[model samples]
Target chain A: MINTEPSRTRLPAVLATAKNSDGARDEPGEEIPQTISPIRTFLMGRSSGAGVDLLFYGVMVLCAVSIFVIVLAIIFVLFQNSALSRHQFGFTFFKGQDWDPVSGLFGAWPFIVGTLLSSLIALVIAVPLALGVAIFVTELCPKFLQGPISFLTELLAAIPSVVYGLWGIFVLVPLVRDHVGPFLLKYLGWTGLFGGLNIGVGLLTAGIILAIMILPVISSLTRDVMRAVPTSQREAVLALGATRWEMIRTGVLRNARIGIVGSIILGLGRALGETMAVTMLIGNRAEVPHSLFSPAHTLASVIANEFSEATGDLYLSSLIEIGLALFAVTIVVNAIARLLIWAVTRGAPARVA
Target chain B: MAIEPAGVSLPDNTPGPVPASEPKSTGPGRNRNVLRSVIDHSVTGLSILATVVVLAPLVAILGYLLFKGFSSLNFAFFTQAPRPVGEAGGGMANAIVGSGIVLAIASAIGIPVGIGAGVYLAEYGRNGVFANFVRFTADVLNGVPSIVMGIAAYSLIVVRQHHFSAMAGGIALAIMMVPTITRTTEEMLATVPGAVREAALGLGIPKWRTTISVALRTASPGIITGCMLAFSRVAGETAPLLFTAFGNQFWSVKLGQPIAALPLQIYIYAVSPYDEWHRLAWAGALVLIVLIMASVTLVRIFAGRGVLKGNS
Candidate 1:
């Protein structure tokens, strides 16, 4: 293979004449990263042989560039398909609450409201619980229990959304209807949020389900951020003779708060866009629920429930426009969360891998 | 502060940070010490309570699923299709097969593009603006709702082809899988030390060759687990498959034909007002969760191990 070489490059000389694995015996091309691959020697004279190398690089660049293209194409497709609704409904398409397709009136208001309220409820429940879980796993857990507990917490994120939906249908819905709902009704009815007749499936049910669904996302990211807090900070606080909780609150939580907020927002993004579980649990109504116990439809669930059978062009266009709005909102929210997380982590590779 | 002053005992229920200034009298100082311990212990209790609140639902759901689904599983549940309205015994065999096919196509498309993009981001996209653009886009894209992706697939392929097909469903799932795969791959690859790359370069190996054979091989385990993560996540997607695969009732394997998937079938059954279908949905869900949990368990183990440990 080396006989084909025209010029002398140090690589070719090292490859064709290098010692073998023992580092003492001489065998050409036997020392790989120690020497060069025999394949390199075979193409020595034809330096144009970089064609394969260049092609591989080009393909990778193309694939990377395709991510940009895919996002653009999605934005274009959503906007193009949503044109009719975007035009007829005008720029304020998200304003009104009416969605009567029989008369062709469509507005994103109710869906937006449902998405907001349910996600906000999820955030309200998830943030503290997730933070506690993160803190427990990161700071307070016993050495023997930490690994298993962390693994169990992350496993929550791995469960499918559809399965969560099924569980919500059978298990959660009954629990809410039989116990939690009546209890809230008897005790907290004056607040007006839990007063409606409980049918077992409603915004609050979906919210609770969503809280469970987003818990892993929030806690995992929060854990990573907290873990990213330099160990020195913890040591410094401890050196001051602070208690475990005091050290954690002062050294870890305070440092990790920004990223924790970021993680919560990311969880909120998941809750807002979650489909199957919410669809199964939220009752798929178009109305804005007067009480959290009442039924409602979210932007994502609305799309999932309606898009399949939407026949009229206007109806289809409106659905796509709703999807477009969801696409844009989630993207912006996620981008903001990413920025905040990036600010906290400062480009350090997150432990998500 | 363990300023426990072990002899001091105080019963205070005030909720605030420890006062900056102690009364300086040993009596007040000791009380303040007890106050600090009280606050510390209470915060620990709250956090533990938080952990319990989060985990209780998980245990309840998994336990109920086991109770309901295990009792319902039968031979027919794995080997047969849904027997029309009244018949008692049938399985999601077709949906299982369809899910396999769709996942194959998704893995075919998603893994390569995702890993290739990840390779670029880690190796070449270090400082460039375009790389940052790609990174930001990947994060945002990861957060894009699955239903929206379903609509995109419906518009791009289903509408154009004039039918729901497994291929369209596969494409939708593939798109969803990309951001995750890309991110995981990039992170895993980043953990491959640069000195290794420099060594390969020093040995006169081409940059691409060093990346593929050297870096990728070193990072393969993490990357493989990353792909599995994407696979398991996509396996349970119902929203993306709603209009794309469209959830067939009977067996259909052709790429062009609508196909059933485990998640989609479970969804259809769960929403239907039939006791029999409800049972099947439970069984199907049980199967899906079991399958997903197996892979998830792998991820949990690998992820918890801190894959880059000594390399970094």
Candidate 2:
């Protein structure tokens, strides 16, 4: 049918062509031409091209989606575990002070206390030292000594926390237990906190270890902040007949206060979340102790010590809940720090403008 | 407050002459200067003391570690596997190899994803909500205790498979590595000049292509340094590996099986009561320290070169 239709349609074209040829006079050497089909070009153009733009946008969307997907996955897995969710929902999980896994009871109070106490101790030890290091490097130290001293201070950060744990276990703990603890007990034994029998692995040891771990962080951040203070400010203070120390205190430190606070907060965050070193030195006992010398547990150390053996639904859930608490704490700490830093540095730039 | 424009030197002690009309009183400025000197010296001394206090333990520990660990570092310690606790003539070959494999896997998985995210944040998403989200997430992840990551990895990867394996350990290490690399990569990419990006885009190149080819290339040295920092961090992590990889007894190359890492081995040996194990622990520590120091040195060199090139 299709062949017949094409032949039937060609009859009119043939007649028209014959008529045209009869009327027209052709040049002797002229060649007759065949017409190229127009429809074919449109079909080729349509067939050859693909949706390149669609593909590009598709990939970009995919790339962006993956990040959200990963975050969702974390939330899902954490929440999906019934063991973790059930225990976390209860008010007692956070409020209750006791945390004994053997009886299937869990409370985060002691761990929270330990985390706070250790971090606070670390801050007390590290802040002044870090400030000193920053000041010395930026203001006090001779030019030749500056590089080596700064390098030495930063080297502390390079050493792993676990190595610190190992050192604490072998060297620090022994020194503390044998000599330092004994001496402190003898001298300050009247204080209830220091009166306890020394086991060596307690708040003091953990704090000291944490101080060592966090010093470099504080020192490095403070040094950077101090360096950011304007040279003109330093000069102005010095020109005002202020001594070098006064210049640094009023000009450099006052200007960098927010940055310093940020550094300290960062250090505190590190102290709070530190795991292995605290796990090793904290003695991993669950009970809250009034005495600094008594062994304790932090949220991080608790998770590290027990998560492996945690088989029960409540036990596993409690651990996850502890993690959630840690997450919340860190977010809050970082947010506050960022805000504080913004406030401090924000004024300086505006004044400059 | 303005200084004289012409060539002139200001005297150190003289106050700018207050207008002569102001009443001149007793020269309390001199006494003030004396008080200032006292405060200055005290601050300087106090600051010096504080620096010394923070530094003392580091020096002491390094000195002690070298004194103790170096003595135990003989050829035998590196050539052989760890012996029985009381037995002698063993090294940390198995632990060393295991650590190497884990770190390699971690670097491979972490570097690309981290650098890509960083590029996105710095180039396309600067000041955008997504960038803010990523930044916050990265900070939180970095602050997430390594032990928690280990637990999470254990629950998700290790326990699901019902086995402890090196891959699981690698996954845990990668989790730790990601935040570090992300942070470092973002910082490094930020260090690259906006002019470079503008120049590339001005040529009509696609934004993504320009970012990958131009911006990333310029920031490569800093990125590498960041990677090294991340590597050094995970290399020494023991808690995560403890739960995910668990420790192996003999030398084994199987990724699906439990493997011994240097840090875990050190943890075990250091805590163990045996004298031989203690010696081996010290040896393992020394090796880890050397490896870390070497990587750090390499990173500093690369970063320094990048800075020098930028200056030139």
| Among all candidates shown, the one with the greatest lDDT | 1
- For residues B120-204, write the lDDT of model 2, one tens digit per residue: 6766667888778877777666766777677777778886899999999997887678777777777888988899989866755
TM-score of each: 0.88, 0.83
Runs in model 2 lying further than 4 Å from the true structure: A1-68, A82-85, A342-353, B1-36, B194-209, B303-312
lDDT comparing candidate 1 with the true structure: 0.84
Give a tens-digit lDDT track for model 2, residues A1-353: 98799666565554544455543523333333243233334334543223543454345444334445555555556566535545455777776777767776778889888899989889998888888888888777766677898889888987777778878988888888898888988898787658576888899899999998999988888876776665677677766655566667788899899899998898888888888888889888888867778899888888878877788888887887787677668767877766666665555533432
lDDT at position A143, candidate 2: 60
Candidate 1 is graded, for docking, as: acceptable
Measured with C-alpha atoms, the lDDT of residue B144 in candidate 2 is 65
Candidate 1: tens digits of C-alpha lDDT, residues A160-277: 8888898998888998999999998989888878876899999999999999999999999998888777666766766566767777889888988889889988898898899999
lDDT of each: 0.84, 0.76
* Tens digits of per-residue lDDT for model 1, B1-312: 121111011112222334444545569677778878898889889998998888888888888889889988888888998889888888989988999899999999999999999999999887699888898888877888999999988898998999999999999999888989899899989988999999887766788888988899788778888998899989988899998999899989999999989999999999889899999998998999988888777776775564564244
Clashes of each: 1, 2
